[model samples]
Target: MSLKILDQLSQDFTQLLENSYDYNVVIEVGKQPNIKLYKAHSAILYQRSLYFRQKLTNATKKNNVIEFKIPNLSVQTFDIIIRYIYSGIVSLENFEAATIFDLLIDLNEFQFIELVERIQAYLLIIMLLGFHPSMIFNSDDFKTLQENAFIALLKQDDLQMEESEIWDKVILWGKARTPDLPSNLEVWTDENFKSLKATLQHCLPHIRYFQIPSEDVLKKIKPYHNILEKNIWDDILAKYLAPNVPIASLILPPRKKATVQLPSRKASIITPSSSIITLEHIAELSSWIDRRSKIYNTTEIPYEFKLLLRGSRDGFTVLKIDSTNEILGGYNLLIWKVPNGKYSERATTADSFIFSLKNRNQSILSRVKDESTAIVYGKISQGPIFGNGLGMGRRSKSISKEWYSSETVYEKPIRNIDAWFFIDEYEVFQICKI
Candidate 1:
């Protein structure tokens, strides 16, 4: 069966001992109800039986041997210990007893700290775990026992004691009678404040401060509020502060502005040949223009052309010719190499030649108007000049010269004109004379 049931059975037997004045009571052994009692006191026998049962139950629970209180104790104390053994119940009776303090010490000695812890936990549940002066002042033996327990707890090296436990003991000790605590005192003294502050420093985060202190009490402590500067106190306040105002806002100093420096300008020269452009030289220029036409408001130059002169690596000295035929200075015309084998040459006055033709007779001009039409044509006498040709005999044919006299009735149709040609090897040919 379960350990709880076994504990219940042991508790029933212990209860029987506590309620009976003598251990002479009979027990049924199988069907026989009147077995002669053993020489041992029935209470002792019952105690031994309960101890073995508790031992077996504790073994099953993976706990140390169960501790049983000495017999013939007060009924309340007996009940508490018996209930604890039987049902793992934490009984509230004799919680204020000095004997209960010794029992807890003995329980700890037996490695049954769980039971002691449970008792303390139950006291805490009932709000009776805190130190109360009235409870301790009435019993000096209890106070001494409590003080001894506190000393033992303080000396423990392996318990890994909790801060709450320490604070509880501190409260207990603070409530106990001592020469330091005056009988007529109506308020806590400096020594009390010191002890409270030390204990609170360890358990501040766990304590519910708002529940204990009134506004007036808090105001009284304001002058001594330097204790709140401790790390533990700050941490507790930070955790419990209202969300609207941060804890740092209440405790930390205000922030200050910092100054920053701007970078200084430096002078540097950039040559026309240098690829890196400088901002200073650009700012000093009298005029700035960009020729990129595709972008709506962009000023970058778009068209590309080359300088006519050879060995012209100097971009600064190169001239620019605008659409208005005006020459501008500065920055070269950048040219890109035409793709494939196609080639183009620039037209200049040096490479061009001019020629002129004149009509002499006014009557011939009037008679040409009578024809109602005039056809004027000319031919090159030399081989193809502007472009490559297969052979000299395959040159373009010449044209005829004719005029309709009636077509020129309004005015004189013949006038002298000049024809310009940039000829390399081409010669002129006359097919008709007018």
Candidate 2:
């Protein structure tokens, strides 16, 4: 028999990740205040993942160091994945089920196909042992699960549920996650259906449409036909009318029956880290930043908001929630000038904007039109002033309609009618490329 030394090899490789002295890549992970910087070598990263290889190929280096920022990923998850990249050893027993599921999705994004498959297999084994899909999908926390994690669950072949019932759960979950959808489907607009489709783009493909009963398809799936691709929906109908004829759509195989009965356990929910806004808001703001007509999905945001200041922590306010629950704020792309013996100074930038996040689905964005006086930096005591559109008085922190108007220096007013309001709390974030 041949001698086995894989254990020692794995241990040595793990040591390299922990104690390497000459690492060149500095990866910044997590949001501010709880962030971590991981020192990694480019060689190991480039060799391990095609995703990292492409990133490294395009990345510019300063001081012989290449930098990467991953703001959306949790520090704990990144730590586990990065170690596995070097050592090829991952122990999943210590992680929560939700965390492991999220790790699988993150691995898929990193182009770690082999690792993803392994993780998915492990999930299947654990799920078969006791944790049933009924427990997971029915739990209160189901809606809070990551999109990728939910999609991964749908890809399983041994799930113990009727195909029609699975379709209902998918629709329910999509409705819960998608914002601003009307409760009554009859009143839904074309845009509303399109939004839900985008939210469930990856998810819809995994449904076993061929296995669903025809009566259920007529009653349940027909109403949401707008969300399905034209060919997929057409093929679904064609299959029933003309069974002998071949259809264009790929019909997924029916799910296999589980041999053992599964016990139930509550699913874990990963709460968002931000206090001010949700992920949907972040996705919308990121689209505005890039000047895109189509908003980015929550899963696809490319920038990270690093906490620069918080009224609760830093003792200052740049954003204020009024008594009427309106969120008002301004963003400046230029630096604040340190007034040189002057009461105030003006700076110019076309990227500056003032905003009103009216609600979850509605927002107002006003970009700088007159760059000559885009922003004004007053004395250190006074807060930010956005070219007469939005302003606050010194020391007292009082807001007045006289100082706020949208007639000049901006595209349009964030607020329709200016009125005095009190500042409850505010926060400032530095947007960094991810």
Candidate 3:
């Protein structure tokens, strides 16, 4: 019977490369004291990598050794390349975007066709969410970018950089890529401008100059005016001055999607700087419940609102002002978890509030005053107000503090009600210290 050798062969091969056992060739990679020595088989190198084959062929005139002094390649990135060569796997976890991009460059240089495709795809995913231009534009890595890769990046609508920042980076990269100009702009001649323009020729069309703000344009772009065509610059300024007048320029829309997500803040009454928002930025909404749809007419508030509660662990409870202009929810503040799970009654001994949000910017906050009072945690209950109401500012001792119960609706109030106090369509918000 033949031996059943699963991934043992792969493991053995990986070990062989790692230990440098019986290797016929040595690759002296990188530069100076930071250099790395990788021992590999010439036969395996030729079979597995077209890049290695060509490189080794050129170096192997008479000696068994082949040395590559790549000053740009880091020892860590080279180790990853060597590991991939032996194991046929690229481990990207725990690595940063700049590292992936550097390895991607090596993969391209060696014509690692399949690996190139795989790494490029991975790089695009990082570009969408992880890659930050600031990490690379100042480095030599930006200068060595392949033309297609550079162009593709310029065309990206979701690059996660402000248009002004992108413009600054493009100028930097262009200057680095172009051949010698005077170090100082004052010493530069017409020839220098022409050379820089030629270098950025393909990239210029994609810059989306119209999207840059006027202040940034005046400050950042004016210095580079010599490199741009007169007509192009004129049109960009015109668009900013008179936006109503449309021009036949290649004006692109700003990237609105995939914005940076702010970190979660706890529901509290103070700001991150510990400033009291209620006393400064916002005021408590009046308890007067006068606003409503006309009789026989049901008008919705036309907004979505949620309550943020600090005592309930920054609980997010959503409510809707219905077409009948009724506040349908004051769902007790609770953290989101699996439904129908057993929960306890949360009692807050301190001040708390709920916010109704029209847009994320505009909010109306409703405050709660405790008279030795407690808001009971319902079995997924909204609020007692939406359940029936705090009947027209009517005070009753015998009502469920929070939950909706079929057994006990509130007893007859002193009056029917002009409207429900807690159930009135009022914008609500809770100050969060997040």
Q: Which of the numbered candidates is closest to the native, going by highest lDDT?
A: 2
Ranking by TM-score: 2, 3, 1
lDDT by residue (tens digit), candidate 3, 232-254:
88888788889898777777888
Candidate 1: residue 190 lDDT (0-100):
75
Per-model CA lDDT versus the true structure:
0.30, 0.73, 0.53
lDDT of 2 by residue, 1-434 (tens): 99989889888878877886798999999988879999999999999989899999999999999999988778998998898888887777555565775676567667787777767656654454222677767789877766656765677676778889888988999999899999999999999999999989988999999899899999999999999999999999999999889998888898887332122112122123346766677777877888888887766677666554455543441465556566777777776544654368888888888877755457888888888888988753355688877775433322222134454787887777764455666666666566
| lDDT of model 3, residue 173 | 75
The lDDT of model 3 is 0.53
The TM-score, computed over Cα atoms with residue i paired to residue i, of candidate 3 is: 0.36
At residue 87, candidate 2 shows an lDDT of: 85
Residue 56 in model 2: shift from native, Å?
22
Q: Sort every candidate by lDDT, greatest first.
A: 2, 3, 1
Clashes of 2: 0
Assess every candidate by TM-score: 0.19, 0.37, 0.36
lDDT of 1 by residue, 264-371 (tens): 222132122212212222222111223212221112212112112111121011111223221111221222121221223221111111111111111111111222
Q: How does residue 279 of candidate 1 score in lDDT?
A: 26
